[model samples]
Target: MVENSNLLAEQRRALILDEVRRRGGVRVNELTRRLNVSDMTVRRDLDALARQGVVEKVHGGAVPVMEASTHEPGFEAKSGLELTAKEDIAREAARLVAPGSAIALSGGTTTFALAQHLVGVEGLTVVTNSVRVADVFENAARGGSAASPAATVVLTGGVRTPSDALVGPIADRAIRSLHFDLLFLGCHGLSVEAGLSTPNLAEAETNRTFVASARRVVAVADHTKWGTVGLSTFARLSEVDTLVTDSGLPAEAREELAEHLRSVLVAGAEGPATSG
Candidate 1:
């Protein structure tokens, strides 16, 4: 009986997830009627999904995790998204780094792309909360770049989330003690009102520490992220020294962002040479 019940529960949850994905979000009452289950059962199913980072439970129902900034996609799921824009943004972000600069990178596909570009840069002291980003540099250092100045990679110890970001008191404490010349920040969403935001609450808190630790904060995001508000705000537009995004950003929105940031760098699809 126990095994059969468990199988039924799993089946129900799958249906709920499918419904949520199809409709973007679903109300609890609607789910109860469709599933022919009590409100409590529906809530229980939603709670389970929430724990897996599959769906974010709101007041009445649940929404697809990817639709809101409060729920983040896994690292692999996000990697394939916005590839062209991320590569262009990464190329431009690389131009801002000088040799031997101490830099901090917050986790996101955009920042990871930046990491790939920076592997060839000599003499970098990198501090990060991303395991993948550190691994990228670590692999590059093995039997590679013999003549290039050795880059120091610092990986923080903390609880890893679905986004593969290390966060918690451990990461926060480490960031407080060190300072960096620049911070290459990435986010789930960006808005003039929300500033730089992320869906995961812990990531938001850790990113705040990253903001405080860096002299210059450069945010790298794609155009699709504009105006999308996440659950937590890490830094305001005023806190960022520069905003780097692709030219896919609307002109009017660019004008609005220019009002808040020190500088806005638009990387064209043509690549770094064309972007100023």
Candidate 2:
């Protein structure tokens, strides 16, 4: 009986993720009626998800965590928001790339921007789940801009999320067999407490695999992500080897991050740049 109850709870939580994905938010009353569960049960489930950083509990319902802080905007939308900031962060990230190295690039606007700078890097192998990032490398190959031997790019196969990340079991399975010299990851939110997080649960799960596969982890995010807390925590602040962010990060926050992370690279002056 206990096992069956646990199964049911897991099933219900999966449904809740689906519902929230489809509707953007879910009212407790509606969930209670739809799941045929009591109001207390629905609240309990929401509470559980909240603890995992998957959803934000509202006054009477729950909203997707992406919507909580700047809404983890789409690729194009996010790309435009922090152009200069991302460029600076990307440039700094590119500096970390070594020739003849294997690396994983997780999907996010900042990482995508970093892909732009990596085009000329020689003998690099890139494993990524972002269609856009792969396209950049592919186009660069076709353009033939002197990346002698060219960069090898691997695209992960999986369900695409709102943030344009390919995730789920297929992506997870693909990453498990590989090891990387570095993993340049992007996150929707970052904090001293919650660590690195994203709004999508599957993306978060896949990101954890990226963390496990890489010898070093470098986070590329702008200052805007400082206080935002997403629905899922993929890694803690201490787990990251380096943080490449813009000057916009408050002094206090930078001091805090510097204390935990192995190194923190600040980009240009703290204004007019966008980040994920």
Best by TM-score: 1
Give the per-residue lDDT of model 2 (tens digit) for 100-129.
999999998899899999988889999999
**Cα-based lDDT for every prediction:** 0.83, 0.82
Q: In terms of lDDT, which candidate is strongest?
A: 1
lDDT of 1 by residue, 7-114 (tens): 346446656765676578999998777667788998998997787565898989989776655677799988876677788899999999999899999998899999
Screening candidate 1 with a backbone cut-off below 3 angstroms (N, C-alpha, C), the clashing residue pairs are 69-199
CA deviation > 4 Å runs, candidate 2: 1-72, 145-147, 269-276
Error of 1 at 94 (Å): 0.2
